[model samples]
Structure formats: structure tokens, C-alpha cells
Target: MNHDSYPDSYIRGILNTVKTIAMVGASEKENRPSYFAFKYLLERGYTMIPVNPLRAGEQILGRHIYARLSDVPVPIDMVDIFRSSRHALPIVQEALTLNPRPQVIWMQLSIRNDEAAALAEAGGMKVVMNRCPKIEYGRLSSEIAWMGVNTRTISARKAAASGGIQRLSLNRASVPGGATEAAAAAERMERERGSAG
Candidate 1:
């Protein structure tokens, strides 16, 4: 697991498998990166739980905010840390305490701690560092390319237009199959959970 680079399949696998994500350090500010990311992932259909100590007991995008990961009532398939690298260790430490620990520990862009990654990995969780899941989803799904951004990925198949919005799946395919793939991914995740449990 090289933190330097990740395979497209690995990222696609994660983006496809994860259903609920707990975004640590989520902010209420609309202009903040975390806020933007939270909104994006939510729109993309991932159940988002915001974790902000100061904003606890409040709602961000209609979802209640918790003071800490431990305070989250639901199982978090992935924990997306929007905090700095220095705070990553303690955050990972806390995430490790969950009854069914999160399957993934993701550190946001520009935030990476080898020690934290090691700790999470040692706990049997997959770790992604210095990457934004929002951006990864866009890139892997070819959504960024719709915005005229160079995703460096070329596909032979043209995406189907839905209400003038081009939505592609993680495997670089179009809609109808994306939904099926999502179902399959969920089944796979459940099977993995069954074996692990």
C-alpha cells in the first residue's frame, strides 16, 4: 500500500463499496472544503455523518453533527478525516474503538501521517492518505471530465446524458449498469463483512 499512488481499481473499489461515511472535521461553512466535500458525497448517495466537536448537536445539510466518532450512532463504513496530519493519530485511535471498526480510514488531501496509516492498517482497516474521496469519485467516475477537467482518462464509450448531466460510473461506464454495480458492490461488502465477522 504505497501512499505515493493508488491504482484506479483500488479507488474505484472503495468508492463503489462504501455506503456510509463519517466525515471528521466537517464544517458548517458553505465555503469550506469539507462542507463542499460533504455535500458532494451526500449527493453522490453516500450516507454522510458529520463529526465536529464544536458543532455537535447541530445539523449540517440536515444531518446531525456529532462531537466525536464515538458519538455517531450508526456504523461508519469509512471515516474521512478532514483534519490536519497532526490530528490524524488521535482520530485513528478513536476510530479503532468502534465495535465494528470502520473498514477504511481516509485522510483528506494534504493530510497524511504514516504513523496514523500504520496504526489503522494494523487494525485491519484499509488506509488512504492525502486524497479527497470527492475528487477521487469525480475522477474515477469521469465526472470531472464533464467539467472540462483533464482526468487523464480516456474512454471509448460516450456517457449517456440524463437531464443534460453526464454521469459516469466508477468503472468508466454509464448509468444503468452503475446502479447494478452498486448493488453488486453492496452484496460483496456484505459478504466480506460476514466472513470477517
Candidate 2:
């Protein structure tokens, strides 16, 4: 796996598969990027565990914060490193200690450690460097595109509206650009409704 560039399928697969994410270096402040990502993924149905030594034994968004990876009670599907690049190796080493190690180790944007990625990959885990899972999820699911951000890809399929926000799925089966049968049907139905009104 190349660390410089990632295929959309690879990112989408991980995003679709992982259910539980442990965010290392998570912050309590709402203005922090880690907090924002945690909130976004949590709202999208991912179980978010905050790992911050300073805030240990406390709760962030109702989820208990643990001081270290070993402190987490349940199995983690992914370890999202919100810390700096220099701290990645030790964090990856700790993640490798898990009995059933996480399937992925994701370093946040602007945080890349080739040594950490090499170690995690050597442990048979998929490693993503210098990227944000929250951004990837939104991009692959067309959630960010709806927010007026150009994702460099176009799709005619309308997102499933929930709570007045349009959201799409990364189910892998559905093709982009309204190619899926269900998407086509929904497009037609929306057109008819527009005509009727």
C-alpha cells in the first residue's frame, strides 16, 4: 500500500467497515479539530472513544475518556491519532499491543510518520497517513459535496435525507453518478414530484 496516495475504494472500504474508533489525543474543547471529527463520526453512527490522559475518567460527548489505549474496555476497530507526528510511533506501538489489534491506524491531516506507518503495516494493519477519516467519510459518502465543497467528483444520485441533511452511504454496491437502479428510480420519482408540484 502506497503511503503517498490512497485509492477511493481503500478509504471507502475502511470507512464502511469500521464501527468503533479510538481517537488518541482527543481534546475536550469543542473548537478543536479532534473534537469536531469525533462529533462528526459519532453522529454518523460510529462509536467514538476519546483517549486523552489529561481528561481521563471524564466524559466527552457522553463517551468515557481513557488515558491510554490499554485503558479502553472494548475492542477497537480503528485507532485515529490526533497527536503530532513525533508521537505516532509510541501510539502505534501501543495499538499493536491489543489482543485483536485494530484493523486501521489513521494519522490526522498534517501528521505523518513513515516509521509509525511502517510499524503498523508490518503488524498487518492498514495504515493511513496525513489524512482525516472524518473528511474521507464525508467525501466518499457525498456528505461534504452537499455542503458546497467540491469533491472533484460528480454524482447524480441524491442523498437519503435524514433530519433535513442529505446523506449518502458508502455501501460499495451503489455506483456513482446515479448508476444504481435505486438511484435512477429515486431520480425519476423526484422529477415527477417536481412536475406535479
Against the true structure, candidate 2 reaches a TM-score of: 0.83
Per-model CA lDDT versus the true structure:
0.82, 0.82
Model 1, 1-197: lDDT tens digits are 98666666778788889999999999999999999999999988899999999999999999999999999999999999988778999999999999889999998877778899999999999999777898888876777767875454556776544333455566555322123455445445543443343
Show pairs that collide, candidate 1. Answer: none
Q: Where does model 1 exceed 4 Å of error?
A: 157-164, 173-197
lDDT of 2 by residue, 1-197 (tens): 88656667788889988999999999989999999999999998999999999999999999999999999999999999998888989999999999789999998877777788899999999998777898888777767877875443455656544453465665523333323566445445543443343
Deviation in Å, model 1, residue 24 alpha carbon: 0.4
Per-candidate clash tally: 0, 0
By summed lDDT, the worst window of 10 consecutive residues in model 1 runs over: 174-183
Quote the positional error of residue 30 for candidate 2 in Å.
0.7
lDDT, model 2, position 116: 88
